[model samples]
Target chain A: MSIGSTIICLLGALFMTSSAFGQAMDAPTDLAGTGYFRDQDTLPGSFRFYQQLPGGESGFWGMGPSRPNLRRSSFKIDAHDDVVYYSPEVRCQKCHEPQTKDLHYLRMGITCVQCHRGQPVAGVYQYYSPLNPIRRHAYVCAKCHEGATPSFASYMVHEPNPIASEAQGRFPLLYYAVWFMLILAGGVFVIFLPYTVFWWIRDLVAKLTRRPSHGS
Target chain B: MAVDRTRLKRFPPVQRLWHLGLLVVFMILSVTGIAWMYFETPWGRGLAEQFGGFTGTLEIHRIAGLVMLAGFVLHLLYMLFKIDWKRFSQSLMGPDSLVFQWIDIKGFFAHLGWVFGLRKYPHFDRWSWWEKFDYWAVWWGLIIVGVTGLMLYNPVLTSDFMPGWLLNVALWVHRIEAVLAMGHIFTIHFTVEHWRPSAFPYNASMFDGSVDLEEARHEHPAWVERLEREGRLEGTLVPPPPVPLRILYFVFGYAIILLGLFLLVFAIANAALLTLF
Candidate 1:
């Protein structure tokens, strides 16, 4: 072959090799077919830069790279435990349709992420569970109900279901009782605190002057 | 040394100590309890922080409540054992007792008349009608507040016997009773016993357990006359309180009174602001 033709052929072969490698990198993984699972990768942009890692597992394959199967490796089940794991693909309405009838937020079409902290997108959701030791329900409730008064917060959160129902049914009773006591106490204070202070000052002045004090 | 015939015994040493202890404990309970109730308010928040935060405030409140309960129980036991039961019972039913009697109704009207200038100061015995009211009201308050306080202090244990709603009820009752007791003590009781023109600044009889004989005669002539008839006037005479004791009384008495007055104003102002806004 002529040297110029040989150089052109070599350049073409190099281009083909590089292009083939690029195609391999760009191709999507057949994650389910490979018996591997991406724990929380269902949400778009949720695992953005780390999508290739797939559930944070590490391995190399000739075709491309093997993604992780979190279910098989990282996930463990104990017979003694009672934890239930709901799939991200399952909508809350699917199971909670009965309970959501009276829930205020659910009726308003506000999803779990509104009050809960975490990512929820592209048919997937991830949040701190109540079972988690670090995150408590009160902290989550406070995220949205920060402006609520202490009494209201206690009534809503701490009171048992029956007590809360009764309290709601007789809301006016609690309201009036609190106000009545406050007003009664305030009235007594207003009537007597200033009256006593005034008399005390007057008596002090009378003693200093050695004068006969009124009502003495 | 000649006995200071001008002074007469009022409260004895033990009674004086009990009163002083009660005053201190009651003040502590009020401060800690109010701070807990209004924990979100600026003053309340500041107080909680000063005491090492919300849990610390709660612990202090519970401890103060327990102390108050102990004091009350001890006082009751002391009265039961130390007092002559027959005399005490007779006194409770008699004209000299601090219990509410038919005469108190007459005395209350008489006092109202005196206030309106329709009569002179009605003759008062050892215990006036208002004084009787104060004593009985305290007893009633102790029972209600004490029981509710115990229930609240042990909600988990109490929940087994009582419905959960009862805890809520107990909370309201405890808070309301506290307010009532505080209001009565800081206002009517303080005014009648310490802030009155005759006892202005304070009634040091609670500290030194003695009163000026002339003032005692003026305030409780019926008791003085009875004592004189029984020839016990001389027996009740005591030396005038020494200067140092008087100074100490003035300092502690005024401090407590002034602190109570400040709290009263703060509470009322906070309540008004809360109600209006």
Candidate 2:
């Protein structure tokens, strides 16, 4: 064979070997593929972050009558007790309507899954779960809100007003004033403490030696 | 035979009792209050557990606060009974009173000068400027902490008349004032009273209600001179603290001083860590 044909054959072998290795490793076709759920033997949709059975009225058996309107698009559970259908994608608005309705950041068009993407339990998204296990909402807030001026980040988003115009709010001025006083008092005490210790030591030594100290 | 040296009556017996009561109550309040404020700390958590958890700690703190308030009220009543109407009115007016005087400003500056080796020690009367400051700080702390504490103790009720934020303000004030009061009493007041070279070891005058004649002459020469002029110098003489009581003072006083020092270190460390992290 000619040198050019030999080179082409070698390139073909290399490409085939790489493709085989990739398939063996179960590498995703696209970098952003959602990946498959092994237990259910189905591909998880882009929106479905959790792996558990869908929860809510239609998700749980005997909880309520199965609503055909809320059936899943991709998968269905066919058990002896009941057959249920679930959507390919699990959206947070399906369960948490009240909390997510008038959220300040949601008004900015930020999706819930953007901040809360993980599946805490098998069918429960992190934000939808009652127990917020990884409580780092402050750090999350700081990521975007804390820009040039970090002090602005101290403003509590939940309760923005310092004076309680309603049933509940913190007095920021009072909080800061108290902190200032505490820091000032602590600073003064620290500065004076060494002098006191010195005096005490001097007095002790004078008493032991039975000699008259200058101040005494 | 050596002539028995005369001592001067400084704090009266009633005054001494009040001081002791206030000291003990203040210490208890400080411990419980600080523990509750910093409940996340190991020492605070241990104290809470020792006192039977958070609720128990708060109960003890409230009780101690109330006791301190009562003692303060009794002190006010005692002063009312002791002082004549004329003296009371005079105290309301400036000089020779515990109220800050122009002389105190001068004396404070003079003392600063003396401290810097610019002059001799300023001649102090019955109460030095710092002593008067210490006295009034207690009154200030009591009013602020007491009123705020009352508001916080019944926040639900208080919120009916006032806004809920006011209760928040009260809580902030109460905690800060408590810290300030504890810090002042444990460090500055302790230093002035017990750790001063002149007051070396401890000042027994508050405990025993008597001062050594020489100490009286040295520390409060103006007052001693005034007593002599009034022919009350001899009347002021009293026996020193009894041996057993002195021994008790020696032990308890040192222990208290050491405890205060330890607390001072802990407070500083806690503050530094909190600020840094």
Candidate 3:
């Protein structure tokens, strides 16, 4: 590429990376939706407004406070005494359903832990989030936290390697590496080798037929 | 006074043989090595498969790696013992020379300017910065590629001590380095040696063991001047010594051509198969 193109691409890349960081930080930390949070009394599906459900509960569709503040409700339910995990083994996939209904759901840029909080599978507090929310126990959290030696970020923070899926044979790196290299080598050689061979033959014919030009 | 042919200051017989040997070995190794790396390409994977499997590429790659290592050692010995060490050092690594100096950055730009008629031709001496860069790049590449290549081939040995993630990093570095080396060879090296206007056909100094006096003066003026100063000047327009290299050239050339053809056929077949996928 020309110097101008290189500089333009570099500046563009820098701008994109900076804007990505900006968008990440701009994400709302509070679970409450914007307009609905204007008044606490009119919190979606609260007791004061609609208390005529099958179970005499105010929430619609029996979805316990399907409002975004369910996360806040969970926090309020257990204030002083924090919920914990106490499982022999703990893994992120246990709660996160390794495959979502939509392929793009995971690819939608939503952080998994943002909604599925606590010790992944074996950790449920009050407010009853999922139908079968696993209760929090100390042992489950200890798998990744509270170690003498600091564990990896995957353990402590749950940051996954971006290329993890590709590395795990989901995408065939070896297949590409082997085939691409061979094909490229062959294709390129095929393109040029004929000229080289012809040149060599031409040189040979010149040598046999006449006094050589002795071109170096 | 006319000089006897035997007393002429040509490269030593062993040096010439060593150069030729390395040239052949390195060429094969480079070809096979590169072929393996591009295994996803039509030729690369097919060649690897023909060798038996993925392990075949590794085995051949290791063989080439050994040959290259031997070449490197022999080169060092030739540098230290066979050649005039002072001349070699001055030519190959001397810092005070413009060829090895930072101003070669200017030479590069100046050459580009000459390409567009903004400046005169770059009057380089002994070695251009590009040549020096090529030399240094080879050494750097050998170390980086050689070490990583060994580690990758023998995972059992590596896994004994090193972390798993380190292997990943090494693979990344080795692959990228190969790409860089290939690019430099095909483009910069090709242009410098053969694609230049004067040297359009080819430069046979490496094969013929003597450069044309005019070429010596033009391309490497310092060496020519040094020879004159030392009263070691050969004839300005003497024809090259009869090398009898055509037979050798035909043999090596045809071998490469045949191998290249085989690779081409294999690659085409591989592409057809991949299309079915």
What ordering of candidates by TM-score runs from best to worst? 1, 2, 3
True contacts kept of each: 0.08, 0.19, 0.00
Q: Which pairs of residues collide in candidate 2? A: A52-A122, A52-A123, A72-A85, A72-A86, A72-A87
Which DockQ values do the candidates obtain, in the order shown? Answer: 0.05, 0.08, 0.02
Superposed by TM-score, candidate 1 places the C-alpha of residue B10 at a distance from the truth, in angstroms, of 0.9
Give the total clashing residue pairs for model 3.
34
Better of 1 and 2 by DockQ: 2
**Candidate that beats the other on lDDT, 2 or 3, i.e. the better one:** 2
Model 2: residues with Cα > 4 Å off, grouped in runs: A1-172, A179-216, B1-5, B87-96, B270-277
Question: Cα deviation of B24 in candidate 1 (Å)?
Answer: 0.7
Q: What tens-digit string does per-residue lDDT give for candidate 1 at B1-277?
A: 6645688898888989988998998888887777666564677667678778777878988998899899899988986786567677774576555668777898778766655446555677787787776677778778878998998886545544543335555676678889889878877787878866667667888899998987877667777888899898989988888899999999998888887887777777677433111
Please give the clash total of every predicted structure, in order. Answer: 0, 5, 34
Q: Write the per-residue lDDT of candidate 3 for residues B1-277, one digit (tens) a residue.
A: 5633432233446746765775566556656765565455656655667667656666776787788887887777765564455687665445323235665887667655544435544666556666666666677777777787777665434644543224444564566566555544554455455545456556655555566665556555655666678676754334445557745654554464455445445644555433111
Give the best candidate by lDDT: 1
The ten-residue window of minimal lDDT in model 3 chain A covers: A148-157
Task: Looking at model 2 chain A, report the run of 10 residues with the lowest lDDT sum.
Answer: A74-83
Worst 10 residues of 1 chain B by lDDT: B268-277
